[model samples]
Target: MDIIKNIKEKGDNMIYILDTANINDIKKAMDIYPLSGVTTNPSIISKENRDFLDILKDIKGVIGKETMLHVQTLSTTCEGIVEEAHYIRDNVEGELYIKVPVIAEGIKAIKQLKKEGFKITATAVITANQALMAAVAGADFVAPYVNRIDNISGSGVNVVNDILNQFELYNLDTKVLAASFKNVQQIADVSNLGVDSITVPLELLDKSIEHPLTDWSVQQFTSDWKKTYKTDKIIIK
Candidate 1:
């Protein structure tokens, strides 16, 4: 039997979600790659300078019904966060994942949202304990900030590995979505740890898949072909 190691199912595989609110970038990524979904925060949304609902709708329209669109809440209180989540769910069409910070109030909100059968992603996680707690509280996903942890002289890849260890130890089903990267190498490092997903910026993600060597190789092939045939063609005389 031939064994293949690159099958990527959306829920089970290493999901590739673009972390941007720019409409054009989302569309371009979807067109090029099998993008799993999208994630957005207030900062990312504010960069567009459009009405919040309009932006969400535009993104949903582009991603369609199957792919999820995760939106972060602005409230610090459990009640406020729950109410805000409800409002967003009522307005946003299709599958919407609410992104709550892995804080005290967020844990409470996640519990309530889980009871209500809402898909929740616990964000702003930095430690293994935080991700574990979010998983126990019924968050479908936990997003760890890889580069932010590294900026403070910590190993982001190690932190992600620790989180994965705890989840396996406790047999938690919560998916780990690594976020906040500074470069493409960070992505490779995190993915090496077998993270369930990654939400990357369009610029760095684009850079990750391209190289000067690839362009040079194609140019060389074209040049060699043209030198012999006068044109790059399969027709040989």
Candidate 2:
């Protein structure tokens, strides 16, 4: 029942997060799995065609106060980014982590937000150098897009690995929140490296814990038990 203790015993305490803003998907994922947070981007938000603040509040209502909600800033300027960060904090309930990109203005905004005592998560990072810059800027978390990196002739998992090594070498406080995964294997491989967390789509979330052989074995056990007991249900006094 102690999840943290079990994760420590397994030698990996990787946090799981759902990477979509769909309220139904978030509710379903949390109902079926142990999730630490939910992450969103401009692209994900654009899909809903709904009011941004209402969607955020609805997501918070589903995930509750215990889970972290990550919302990205759409601004490309430091001032605009800061404004959006403040608006999100003022409107959204519970703990919020504002996601800023690793671009020029974004870095400046991150530095400013950090100085102002905000929970900053640097996102859309394609290279290890970008992640390093986010760390140097004092971000609470850095997200490396795994599948997107591979699409551009680079290894996404490798980028995450390199960042982890750099964070360890320099003793940075930033945690890598790997994102943009197309398959379950990408998450499994990165979890082995002991990355801090990963945000995956709902479709691939349950796949990591399922196997066809396991289902077959369970069916066989049920059949054998029914034959011996003459009933599928357990009898109790």
Candidate 3:
């Protein structure tokens, strides 16, 4: 299967968030490869200063077809939320996943939307119980704000683990997507625990491939290459 299809097939296992804070940043991030999909919020969209449809179109263009592009709903009413979800699905050409908060209204919207065959993601979840509620509401993905939970107390990672454990116990299909990642350690921690997916910031995603030793090793390799090539040139082709 293609990369996008593979990523989506992994579902709860692999999730990459778009944290460019704008459309242009999204484009740059996708250029790096292995970008499964993007998660966007109202705050991130506000920085773009463009209509939601315009921004969605630009994101779909850069991410291409089969990429799961998540957009949060602004309305609190179930009807309004469904309306917005449908609007986004109709307007965007790629795989559009509607992000509903884990509030009561959002849960109502999620159940209704799921019945309508619309993909729904439960966002802003802070606890294991909230994640359970999202799953019971028929959410395709339950996102736990890891960093935010840690900020309040230092148990965000534990919360994510608890959710994962519960889901396995009940055999719920809803995937636990760890969100609000603050650093590479958080990603490593969650990934190590075997959580379904992690929606990380762009900077942290880039940092995941780097470490002090890796950077130093690369610098040393470059220096050695320069010195070796000074006397004679070696070309592959």
Candidate 4:
């Protein structure tokens, strides 16, 4: 079966996003490929060990005004989450997406944030139920922890599929932003499943475009051409 063709038949709305907060990494990755946006949690931000808002502004400066920047709120309560959302918007400029976890308070916070005219991304999602609730709360995107779900003996792709199906059934505007991938295969599988977006690590992004046979074929072709033409450089003049 043609898996790619099958995936296309379902529709092609997938977007590749970078999941990092490092300014150097963002600059490098953006130079290498077209990324829709960048995502960051508290953990990812902590790794940088810089001023929080300054780092966010630096990331915004690197990505520019077009690319979406998703920053998570550390608050566990609805009131605090809403307050943090305003702070993030006040500090970071351009297209922004506020990531709230899919917990009891988070769902409540999402509703409030939506009412306040903020773009919300319901994160830390592991189950279809959480995704469903997040969608019902009017989230712009729902992020499922792919590898993290697998660590708990559940199928991440299945969770993604279930969330997609639920959205289609209800005609919800919330799209799935599949995250926490450890390998390219996971991305390929999720892509085939018709997810709306994916946040990939920079290493996996490089690995996704590489294959042993492709390199081998190129090497063989170059060797044969050099043998016949007796040159390694192409001279236009």
Candidate 5:
């Protein structure tokens, strides 16, 4: 179905998955050229030791123009969440996606945010039903914690599968963002399953570039190139 072409060319049914723990990391990820957006939670922001607005501004500056930047809301009440959503949207540039929990208050805020033309993501979700509810609430993204679910009982992949099936059946626009990835296998599995996108950590992104055969072939090519082309200096035109 030319999935990559459809994703990058048409921009239909495609999502950008980013792994960012801090502003600098988010900037680095965006600098990679293929990153579509950055995702963060309270825990990730807390580790930066910078004020929330300052960190957000830094991220926006790095990931400018049409990139999606998600900021998680900590408030439990719908009113509080809505207020935070407005604050984030007002203060941030480009598209600001508010990350809310999958609880009732979050659903309420999501509905209102959608009505107000604000992008929203329902995060910390672990079940297919939660994905369903988030879609029904008009969430732009539904983030399922794959590794965290596996860490507790090892049914994470199944949850993702169910959510994908449900999304297909309902023709929902809420993209399933497989998150909390622990290894390369999980990334490959989710990508193969056609989950909309997966938010991996920095370590896993590095691991994705590692393959024993690929490494060996690259080393062989470099050695052969050095042996064949002896000169290291370039001639002036």
Candidate 6:
């Protein structure tokens, strides 16, 4: 119990993570929302064009140590993945969730990392079996590519549901971290079924939170308030 205490995840509500490496956007989101953390892959980080330490450290500075930072491994071999994990662990100061693809080699690395008490997020998951195998390998989280599955004409939401059901059936503690959202609808669909964690691109997250009716209603309230009171702010009589 003590060995895996820090890495094990159990929560009643979903956790939200920003799937971006844009430092300015991350800082803005952290200031505005109750964001849980940030997630980055090689593709995302490559866009930043900064050294790994500099990019990650800048994110850490904005989000702070309490928030989780999920960084994916570029290696495809178990040995390489383990070495990369160690490198990141030695440099980063926080609860870093190592994102590994749900492949043969990645599963092996996850098992080794789990034993060493590293927080593992098995990413690139498209099937229930892959998620099941990763969970069996003791992954703290399994990230199923929601939109990517749908793009291939598969029901991403159904896959996510199946993954959640399997975890419950097996009595495993691995959380489902749904990823690759193309739209807010995908996020909402996954949210309805029960996602332990979701890393949303800012555009989709913005869509998820905003509505024209919401804005109009707030505008109406402010207009009505002005008619009754001289001050725009709410206060006691």
lDDT of 1 by residue, 212-234 (tens): 99999999999998998799877
Q: Candidate 6: TM-score? A: 0.92
1-237 per-residue lDDT for model 2 (tens digits): 111111223665678999999999998999998899999999999899999999999999999977899999999999999999999999998989999999999999999999999999999999989999999998999999999999999888788888888887797878899999989889987887778999998999878888999999998988999899877777645
Off by over 4 Å in 5: 1-14, 232-237
What TM-score fits each model? 0.93, 0.93, 0.88, 0.93, 0.89, 0.92
Against the true structure, candidate 5 reaches a TM-score of 0.89
Model 6 Cα shift for residue 18 (angstroms): 0.8
* Of candidates 4 and 3, the better by TM-score: 4
Candidate 2 residue 230 C-alpha distance from true site, Å: 1.9
Alpha-carbon RMSD of each model = 4.4, 4.6, 5.4, 2.7, 3.7, 5.4
lDDT of each: 0.91, 0.90, 0.81, 0.90, 0.80, 0.89
Steric clash pairs (candidate 1):
none
| Model 6 stretches astray by more than 4 angstroms | 1-11, 235-237
lDDT of 3 by residue, 110-222 (tens): 99999999888899999889889889889999889888988997677888878877777787888877889888888887777777777766678778887899889977887
**lDDT (Cα, tens digit) per residue for candidate 5, span 86-168:** 88888877878899999998999889989999888899998889989998998988999999999998667788888877877
Model 1 shows how many backbone clashes? 0
Identify the superior model by TM-score, candidate 5 or candidate 6.
6
